[model samples]
Target: MNVSRCDLLRWQFDFTWSLFDYHLERLQPADFLWEPAALCWTVRPDATGTWVPDWAETELDPVPVPTIGWLSWHIGW
Candidate 1:
């Protein structure tokens, strides 16, 4: 059986999306903003009421862990 390159790529994408969906389905609304550590990155509503993720112009020595909301925003961004 021969699989085209497109077919392989499609399968991989589907598999990855399924894995993401599996975990996403289990997440509660609160989980998106839950901070697992004291020094963590998350999204905050700005003065304009738009949600913004924590960011830095330069990398920090200790990387801040991202909240699920931040990660999701990053993935989509």
Candidate 2:
């Protein structure tokens, strides 16, 4: 597989991934949030104030950090 990733400034691409603006770059972990869709919906802020899992508030949590790494790798690491 041949892939390449780029880290663009947030100001230039705010939530572009969610909108499918471009697939050439991977958004940083702090660039977005993660809204939980369980029995009761909740909003938790990620590194960049994007709603993510509440547990992500800790450094050793299994939420944003891991998910972001996975997304980054999938986007070409």
Candidate 3:
């Protein structure tokens, strides 16, 4: 199945979140708790042990943005 751009992004975020949840809990949740406006999700009883990342508002991520130039190959003629 083809996933859209937003779905792709959601998958990425959810995947990372799931990994973190593994360390905190032994069992998986029953379903995916999606927060549409926040663009994130939460599993039932997943990672409630520690202070989780706030999905309510966009936090200042330390992640570096990709470097792109105007003449990059991505720019099609």
Top lDDT prediction, candidate number:
1
Residue 38 error, candidate 2, Å:
8.3
User: Which residue window of length 10 is worst by lDDT in model 2?
Assistant: 33-42
For model 3 the local lDDT of residue 61 reads 50
Off by over 4 Å in 2: 1-7, 10-12, 15-41, 44-56, 64-77
lDDT of each: 0.89, 0.41, 0.40
Best by TM-score: 1
TM-score of 3: 0.29
TM-score of 2: 0.19
For candidate 1, write residues 4-75 as lDDT tens digits.
Answer: 999999899788777777888899989999999988999999999999999999997699999999987776
Ranking by TM-score: 1, 3, 2
Please, what are the lDDT tens digits per residue for candidate 3 over residues 1-77? 88899999988878866764564355333222324333333322336564233333555455322212111111211
Candidate 3 RMSD computed on C-alpha atoms after optimal superposition onto the true structure: 16.5
Write the residue-wise lDDT of candidate 2 on 1-77 in tens digits.
53344444553355755444364255654444343322322335578986443333345422333343334334332
Ten contiguous residues minimizing lDDT sum, candidate 1: 13-22
Evaluation by TM-score, superior candidate among 1 and 3: 1
TM-score for candidate 1, please give it: 0.72
